[model samples]
Target: MNWIDELTSTLGDSIHCDEACLLAHAGDKWFASHLPDAVLLASTTEQISEAMRIASKYNVPVTARGAGVGYVGGCVPSRGGLVISLAPMTRIIELNPADGIARVEAGCLTADIQDAAAELGWFYPPDPASRKESSIGGNIATNAGGPRCLKYGVTRNYVLGLTVVLADGRIVRCGGRTHKNKQGFDLVGLFCGSEGMLGIITEATLRIIPTPPARAAIQAFFPDFALAAKAVQDILQAGHLPAAMEITDAFTLEAARKHLGADAMPAGMQGHIIVEIDGQERAIKEELPSIMSILQSCGSINAMSATEPEDIERIWQLRREFSASLRATGLTKLNEDIVIPRSALVELVDFCSQLQQTHDIPIACFGHSGDGNIHSNIMIPLDAKGNERRAEAEALVHELFAWVLARGGSITGEHGIGIAKAPWFEGAIGSNAFELHQQIKSALDPLGILNPDKMGL
Candidate 1:
């Protein structure tokens, strides 16, 4: 049978093959879009296994998808292959409240799981910025993180076990519902950020934590980023662990100020750091002063403003709205998720300023500072020169990654290095690690069909 007939015979009309529908499954956040041969809606692990087996037999690349909200083009089907969407598989298989662990389908939304667990007085802490729309599978595949990752850690740390379907359609379970496991190898971790190069994730068992009794938000404004940088170091040095820590500079603040309006934040401030501390009220009262003192000592032009509960919501709304506001700028934003040591943040930010000055580009900078992960978005212009400037943006994007690596940082802090950064894999991980990755891929799929063209075997 032909591709469509063969796929339809197995998956029924649930397969979406229209060119317009296939276009929807093409690409994600950063990579350019392409037409997929077809999109299949999978509802169970059995169905996922069936799809993978057939796709592998046909030698068609299968791009496993969650919500397709990934920033690094991990979910995008760069090759015109099968887009195996897992959205319908979102089911909370088990909520082990007594054990503080839960088993969920890979298609479940990450934030929805958090909300569901929170309602039961539990928490799932590896929150991605796109938690609202991002799926648990995408988070696990990318090992996603957010501001809260400062203390709770990222996705890989929380995933106790996973039910994965190998590239050859064999089901291999790894890890278990336990805190400690010195198994043969840390294959669990190896697959966590594999970006679909290794296997197709069907379900995952996640570790959870007890929700804190109280949570408080702190907002510190800095006249300059340097002072803001110092305040971050001071707060961490003070030995107080915060649930979340984030930084926003002038360009981003301007975007916030304009998109969210003057009331979102003080119009004149050049930088802002929003931190959330949770624990006993007594500890917060004591640490709150120290946090304020650090910001002030770092050089606060005025008494730092207090965020009313309403204002707290307003500020958070502003921060969360940043990605959307950026899209309104009329240019495709090349988001670079780079991580550096806390000490190197100032240098990275400063270098970005130099980069913009030298290349004459506009970039919005912000990130989960407590974790030292920053998103430096280079905005391509909308004028007639947009294409030419776009070339410069693309070139510097890799250059920026190289600079981050030179300073002992990662090309992607939270976002996975999927097809978007696949070209630079050799520069980032070197031949040894890249070879190890290929070896793992070969072991998983000898035919090399799963996400074949995107992540590079």
Candidate 2:
């Protein structure tokens, strides 16, 4: 029987090979598209396991996809085979505050889990910018990190257990709901950032922490980017660990002003820093002054503080709107999430400015400044025909990656090395590490059917 007939007989209407379904599962937020031979809307782990078994039997590539909100083309089925979408399996099996864990289907939205935990006075701290739309499965696949990760850690920290479906349709459960687990092997960590090449995640048991009693935020504006970068180091050196510390350069600040109006930006601000803190109300109140004083000493032009939750949210709202604001400028935003040594933050921004001048293309620099993960976006201007200046942008990206690698930095911080960064994967990890990765991939996915052509594995 044909592959379509077999899938249909096994999954009924859950299997779709129509043009619309194929196109829908083709790509994600990235600028790459390829139609899959068929799309499997899996609603349960059994369906996924069966689909995988069938795909393996047919030697068809099977790419497991979540919400399709990934910035990298991680979910794009580059090979024309089967796309197994887990989005239909959105179920929160349990939220146990007593145990400080939430058992949920892989397709559960990251924001939904945070809201559920918050209702119980608990916190799920991985707040990726796409949390509202990104799925737990996708976050696990990429081991996503957000601003809060500087203090609370990334998605891998919260993942206590996982239910995974192997490429050959075997089911495996690793770890448990307990906070501490020293099992035979750390399979949970192994699969968290495997990029869906090893196995398909079906469900996850995530650790949650008690929510801090109070929260506050401070927004500081600097006359230049150097002072802002200095202020970041100063804040850390002052024995203060903010829940989240973010910075934005002048290019991004100007774009925010143009897109969000003059009022959206602080007056005479060339660089902006946001520092957030959470804990006891009195402690937060006491800490604000010290933070403010440090900012002032760093030559901050002006500083604003938000004590109330609503006020803090308003400040963060501006930070969250940055990516969208850049898009509003009618230029394609090629977001490159690179990481450098904390001491190199200023140098990185300076390098970005130089690249911007050299290429004559707008580059917006912003992101988790406290941790050295900056989203240095190359804003490519389109011609009258509405096509990107691809050649210039590509050349700039190569240079940027080369510079980052030379300085002991990573090509990607949060976004995984999808097809977009595959060319540099081997070089970035070195030959020994790259070969180890290949061996692991071959061992887990012998047929090489899972997420083919991704990460160059």
Candidate 3:
């Protein structure tokens, strides 16, 4: 029987073997034209297991997908494979405010959990920009990091456990709802950023924190990207740790201000920062002065800190929508997630700027500056009728990644190395690590039917 026939007979009409619809699942934002061979929507764990069994039997690549909101083509099935979509399984199984944990189905929206936590005076801090649409499954698969990760950490830090469907259809549970585990392998860590290679995660146990009572924001305008980078360095050196810290240089800041209007920006700013402080009123007062002092010392033209709730929200709104600002500019977009150590922030930004100058391309420099993860992504001119500009832009990006690696940084920070960065894996991690990756992949899915062409393994 054909792959679709087996799925349809086992899963009813919900399982489709249609090439047209399957092809629709091929490329995500990173490669809009890519397509897959088949698509499977599994409503139950058993169905997923069965799909895996069929995929393994046929030696067909199997890829699990979430809401397809990933920025780096993490969900895209580059090779013709069985794409198992988890969107149908979104269900909040339990929320224990007392335990400070939430048990949820993989497909649940990340923000929905946050809203549920907010109602209970708790917080799920690993909120990526696409929180409203991104599934918890995708977040787990990519080990998603967010602006608040500097304070709260990424999905890897919070994901205590998962219910995973193996490549051969066995359902296994890893980790627990507890604080510590001393078992053989750190399965949670291994699966957290597995990029759907190890197995398909069907459920997750999340760690939550108490909601901060008073949150504040501070925006600073700098003369250059280096100044903003230095200010981030200073903030980290200080004893206080803000809940959230972000940096956007003049180019991206103006882009936000331009398309988003005056209200989209701080009252006065070129380079900008949006920070959140969680503590007593006195603590907020104490940190602001130290933060401002450093900003001034770093060549900031002007600075503003919002103590009022309304002002703070307004400031954060600009940052939350910064990624979408590129769409308003009508430029072909490449949201490269490059991260260096905190000490390398200045060097990294300088390298990006120098690279842009040499290439004559424009980039929007912004990211969780405090964490030293910069989104120095460029926008190719959209007006070029031919693919000439696209090819040139693609080559320019490879050059940029080469520099990023030379500076001791990975090609991806929050976003996983989906199809987009798979080819560059050798450059980023070298062949030795790549072989280890292959070994892990082989151990998990012997027939090689999970996210086949993804993550380069």
Candidate 4:
């Protein structure tokens, strides 16, 4: 029998070789897509280990998938072999507040874990925009971050332990429920941002903190992005660390005004900033006014502060609509989540503005301003045939990445270096580091059957 039949015979009904299954598991939110020979809807760790063993035996490439919501092509089954999907393994095995830990299956939705923790008076703070649809395992794989990561830290910080399935089908448990573990090499961290190339994560032990009793938000409008960027620095320099600080460019504001109507925000508002703080009710009340004053001092034309939950959510709703508003412009949006030093926020926006002017491209910048991880989107107009002018956009992406590297900024802060950034991965990490990556990959996946052709490996 062929590999597909063999997978079916061994894995039973969990193995699917139909066109629909193959197509569905082929890609994610990225622009690229390719069909795998077979897809395995994995429901348990054992199933994944057994499938990996079979793939190793057949010398077939294996790609692990989660909820398929990644912006990069991190989970794309580029090589036609087997795609093991962990979406069926959605289970929170334990939520132990006593130990301040939550043990979750690989396919568990991030939002579900957050909601579950909230009910128990705990908080899991990795708030990726796609939390409702993205899987915890995928987040761990990408070492994902968001606006909240400015103060709370990224997914890697919350990961205390992991259950990983090796390329040869060995199930190894790294770290434990303990908040601190220094037994050996940071094996858990080795796989955290490995992008599924090192091993497949079957389960995770995450650290959660107590839920803050009170939270408040402030929305400020600026005449230009430089002042908004300055407000970010001024807020931090003023000895305040917000849970999240998001900034938006004038282009995105105009798009929002056009798409959501003219009343969405103040007219001709060139820059927008949203600051969030959480703590005791008394503390939040005390901090809001001071932060609001700093905003005003930094040239905020208009500012609004909210302490009520509904009011804060309304403010965030506009922040979350940024990408969709850009999409509504009938242009192909190529978003790059780049990171620069906090001190370079103004310089980065200035660089983006110059690029926009030189290339005749509309660039919309927004994201976690406090952390300097800005989403600079390059908008490409469609041709007469309605096809995306992707070639020009991609050329501009090359130029933008070059500029970022020259400025000592990262090409990606949250999204992993999948096919989209593979060409520059080696250079970005340096020659010595690139060699080490290969050594590690060879050590773990000697046969090279797991998630091949990713990260330019």
- Among these predictions, the greatest lDDT belongs to 2
Which pairs clash in the backbone of model 3?
26-35, 27-34, 62-449
User: Could you tally the backbone clashes for each prediction?
Assistant: 0, 0, 3, 0
lDDT of 2 by residue, 1-457 (tens): 9777899999999999999989999999999989999999999999999998899999999898999988889988998899999898889999999999999999999999999999999999998999999999999999999999989999999999999999999999999999999989899999998999999999999999999999999998899888999999988998989999999988888888888888776756778999999988999989999999999999997688999889999999989788778988888889999999888988888898898899898889999998899999999997678888988998999999999999999999899998989999999989999999999999999999999999998
Q: Each candidate's lDDT (Cα)? A: 0.81, 0.92, 0.81, 0.91
If scored against the real structure, what TM-score would every candidate get? 0.94, 0.98, 0.93, 0.98
Rank ordering of all candidates by lDDT, starting from the highest: 2, 4, 1, 3
Error of 2 at 125 (Å): 0.4
Per-residue CA lDDT of candidate 3, range 39-74, in tens?
877687888998888888778877789988787677
Off-target runs (Cα >4 Å) in candidate 1 are 2-6, 260-268, 301-311, 321-331, 383-388
TM-score between candidate 2 and the true structure: 0.98
Question: What local lDDT does model 4 show for residue 197?
Answer: 91
**Candidate 1 clashes between residue pairs 3 or more apart in a chain or in different chains:** none
Error of 2 at 108 (Å): 0.4
